[model samples]
Target: MITMSPASSNINSTDLDYYCTETPTVAIIWCVLGVLCACVGIPASVWLLWVLVQRQRSGTSNDIYVVNLTVMDLFYNVGTAPSMINYIAFRNHAFVLLDEILYSFSAIGRPLFMTCMCMDCFMAVVYPITYMKMKRYRYRLLSCAAVWGITPCIGTINAFIWYSPIPGALYWLLVPTIAICDLAILYTLRKPDPSGRSDVHPQKQRALQTITNSFVMTLVCYLPLMAMGPFLRLMPASDQVKFCVISLLVYIAPLLGGIIMPLLQLHSLGRLRGLLYCTRDSGSSEQPDQQL
Candidate 1:
């Protein structure tokens, strides 16, 4: 609940800051959303990790990325949990800075791993022989290690630079790359094989559907924040309410992926019954956690 003040109303749009004065109700709402993110993210990541561990013997490259993705989500949920309390009872700015650093990790990590997942599928479908040639667990592990190494560097840049564009730039770069991979996958799958085969492999069909769904999820979770920069620029300086709403959505963006990813992985793998502890002997139910 922000009311327009005379000082703010008089400010030039170019010099206006991003901060919007908020009321107790707004703070409470943020706290509640943070609580929901932690409550859902923690157990879901833990459960997914447990499931992955159970199937590690036959896990694929995608599972390696999924493992890191889940870890990043857990980091986001746990690392930012303190901010919920700080939201309701305003804390020192230093605490908020630390939270922003943690957020930067998540912001980079989620899309980074998602891009890995898409690229993995891209190689698998588009170049089967080469994909198989390089398809070792160690290679995937190395890739994950590389992404982990990269996260801190970019995250640090975002943390120290006020209103840094690196995160958004990274997302913009990834979005088109992911789209091309998705389109390539779709095109490759739709074209008939030169071998005169009428049937697509069941696993390929499943993989296509899973990746498409993930791409959609990524867009849903991230597009708003990516678009926020332009929208904010067009908005008037004194429009605090819309600014606050967009700002909240940007803050909540990291959490959306954490909550949705686990459920998406479960559903795509036909393992929803695993949530109930109801054992199933079906082959699909026994499949490894491959979707991200």
Candidate 2:
């Protein structure tokens, strides 16, 4: 008589083989969307990082948050590669854990970094005195370092307990916090400048608008995934239908976030036109020169 090992006694080889061989529709859609987003987001993020590094100065130390956001975008977009390959090829689960861990990095990092940006803007607008006193590159760098160190631990937890709604709920909570900061900044920006410069308020208002738009982008990407998390618990672990729908949405949130984040960051920094429209202006100028 043949005997099975204790660990293998409960394992179902048929289910495992089916899972490895079958590609879900949601996963297919996810791979396609991920590829498209990576194409645009990767280049935009790299360019934005280049611009940020080139323009770095002592007074602009607050840009560390945006720089970190850009890096998160890079991780988010590029990290999809392994999952895409595995899913498209209908391969085994060898890379699934690694892919999920990579995703958790951005999933956790995005909100934390965005909260930092919101708070940075909030303090600058709402309490300039305190902001000025607290503003220091070393402090911000340390804060980012803490976040970097914390991310892997949290991400590892997330990877292990991916089915748990707790992680998703925690990140979802940041949306309201960021929205509150955006609202507070909006209220403050509306008041007349105490400095008595009417011209300055418009620029400030424009900046605030860009920041608000970024918050909106977060909502767009995050809400569906947040809403879907609870439903996951109601479904069975063996439910392929549930997996398809939830997995599509679960990954799409961060994919969309990775895609749109750099554009929003550039807009907030008043560099949107530099990325989108500056080349046209440069071309026009060169055309005139070539005619001469």
- Model 1 clashing residue pairs (backbone): none
Q: Tell me how candidate 2 scores on lDDT.
A: 0.66
Question: Which residue runs does candidate 1 get wrong by more than 4 Å?
Answer: 1-21, 24-27, 58-62, 135-139, 191-200, 239-243, 274-292
- Per residue, candidate 2 scores C-alpha lDDT tens digits across 1-292 of 0001111112222333323236456666677888788788888799889878876864453378878878877877776665676656745454665665566656677777777778878888888899889846777788789778866666566545523444566656877888888888878887786888776556586657657775786688766666665565576655444444554546576677777878776666678766468888788889978988
lDDT of 1 by residue, 168-287 (tens): 688788777877788888888888879999998888778877687767766777776667755666666555544445456565665667678877776666677665556544545657
User: Best candidate per lDDT, number?
Assistant: 1
By summed lDDT, which 10 consecutive residues of candidate 2 come out lowest? 1-10
Note each model's CA RMSD in angstroms.
Answer: 8.0, 6.9
TM-score of each predicted structure versus truth: 0.79, 0.79
